[model samples]
Target: MIDLTKDGDLWTVTLNRPDKANALTEAMLEKLVDIAQDASAARCLVLTGAGRVFSAGADLDAARAGLATSDLWERLSSAIADLPCLTISALNGSLAGGAFGMALACDLRICARHARFFYPVMKLGFLPQPSDPQRLRDLIGPARTKMILMGGEKIDADTALAWGLVDRVVPQDQLRGTVDELSADTLSASPTHATAIKAMI
Candidate 1:
């Protein structure tokens, strides 16, 4: 399930199925894609999860049904990357599987202290979404990216922060506040100004 909350020019999209470790179904992934595509109108957009784990990636049943290799993952990540608004991935916990695409697409990423990061595609015998490797490489570099993708290393939050996989590692209780603080300037700036700045980068 997904929860979208809008406050003026800020849009927060949350994965709400904590019971499933926020694992995504095809319908849920489609909803996220639709939301990201529609989020261009906002000044800032935040992606996060409701529980301790951001996402365990696609739901087990869904993955077994061919969702693991679906092109929707690429479509969703592309939409997020193309958004004119400033985008942040406020990772509440561990990030894994197909969920990595959206997080890697974000302009900024901040994760909770307990969060772990991994994409076990190699171990699971699936290739990652098309854009994920380059996006991830852009953040943390090729060898390090391979350490996760090819070597199957599950990186902890501290290592993620140190390697540039995430921008900050904050306490779980402060995650939303941290996102709000980071978004303040973008939220207050004129849409044109913010968009232009993002474009210039």
Candidate 2:
């Protein structure tokens, strides 16, 4: 359910299961972890999805089927957080649940104008994993993160940008071009310098 392609020094990873709104499965997360680990050789890495979502988060059916193990979640989160290349989430559509964690793990995010961000675990009588709370606080401050987690409020692209959940918003049609431009800029930097800066942050 994932596709990887290289263009010059940039690596693009696309979530390919549009039929399910790109909801992530255990297998998909495993592949994602592998790709993130391997992307170190690329100057930049872009994460996006096909069709209407960057990802809808975990596949509910798979999760209910006991396919999402705690060990696997930890491995996937660590792999994303420790990625060596400059990583960008090209949020081409709305995201929810565990997908928000993936976006949070990225070094930066460029979201589409129509995209919405939400984490509704509270409604499901569950809490997000530990990394999600910490990452959300680090990205958007504790107060806002608390509101998101506690209140279960969904934020639109503009509000997400204003609240620092996303770095920028682009028109849907411009998402690919915008990501290409940003990745090209990232590729223009010295790999060592870029890696150092990302590590420092």
TM-score of each: 0.99, 0.93
lDDT of 1 by residue, 123-182 (tens): 999999989999889888999999999999999999999999999999999999999999
- Best-matching candidate per TM-score: 1
| Candidate 2: clashing pairs of residues | 57-99
Estimate the lDDT of model 1. 0.94
Scored against the true structure, residue 142 in model 1 reaches a CA lDDT of: 96
Per-residue lDDT for 1-201 in model 2, tens only? 899999988889999999999998888988988888887788888889998788887798887776443456666667777887877899999988877777788888999999998888788666687688999998889999988888988899999999999998999889889887777766888988888887787
Stretches of candidate 2 off by over 4 Å are 67-69
At residue 168, give the lDDT of candidate 1: 91
Q: What local lDDT score does residue 181 receive in model 2, on the 0 to 100 scale?
A: 77
Clashes of each: 0, 1
lDDT for every model?
0.94, 0.84
